[model samples]
Target: NAGVIQTPRHKVTGKGQEATLWCEPISGHSAVFWYRQTIVQGLEFLTYFRNQAPIDDSGMPKERFSAQMPNQSHSTLKIQSTQPQDSAVYLCASSLGAEVFFGKGTRLTVV
Candidate 1:
């Protein structure tokens, strides 16, 4: 309910390593969105959750990308065996369709 909190605003991960990002959504807003932005891909929708339930995750990579919302307020995105292409700004947003707010995001750099 404190809006969205993203820790370690910047992160550097070695290739094949793991990088975990956290998110905290606004109160009363049941819809949370995850997106990855890069120079090549632009803004890509990773996944979304509504009412603490996964509504759509079709945009997520089938391999190492994973996301979850165990409660109404927070969610996490984990990348296992991250690759160089995974480097991007991971943003978390919350909305009710009419309005949406995004966090500053974690600038992930894979080296």
Candidate 2:
């Protein structure tokens, strides 16, 4: 149990560039979740998976945001043509029953 592994803990992208955040959930945990944190939103749920299957993505942007749970241990969040508004801390979490564990988060900055 590494909990969740998120790559590129800090990423700086130019306007219009893209950002891809990665996550490796805790082993044996049946659920993985993604969230975005900002001064205004605090923590907003982006998407989630159960048993490696996508469950809900209503909080994601319909055009440039996407999330995937490719296997039991990992998930990804891709944002295309990122704007300054997209800059935020992206967090990943995993849970089995009532306890949920979170990753350090990928901080994306679009300059």
Q: lDDT of all the models against the reference?
A: 0.91, 0.92
Superposition-based RMSD of candidate 2 using all C-alpha atoms, in angstroms: 0.8
Q: Write the per-residue lDDT of candidate 2 for residues 1-45, one digit (tens) a residue.
A: 566889989999999998899999888999999999999989999
**After TM-score superposition, what is the CA distance of residue 40 in candidate 1 from its true location, in Å?**
1.6
Q: State, as a TM-score between 0 and 1, how close model 2 is to the true structure.
A: 0.96
Candidate 1: tens digits of C-alpha lDDT, residues 12-108? 9999999999998878888999999999989999999999899999989989999999998789999999999899999999987779889889999
What stretches of model 1 exceed 4 Å from their correct place?
A: none
List the candidate 2 regions with Cα displacement exceeding 4 Å: none
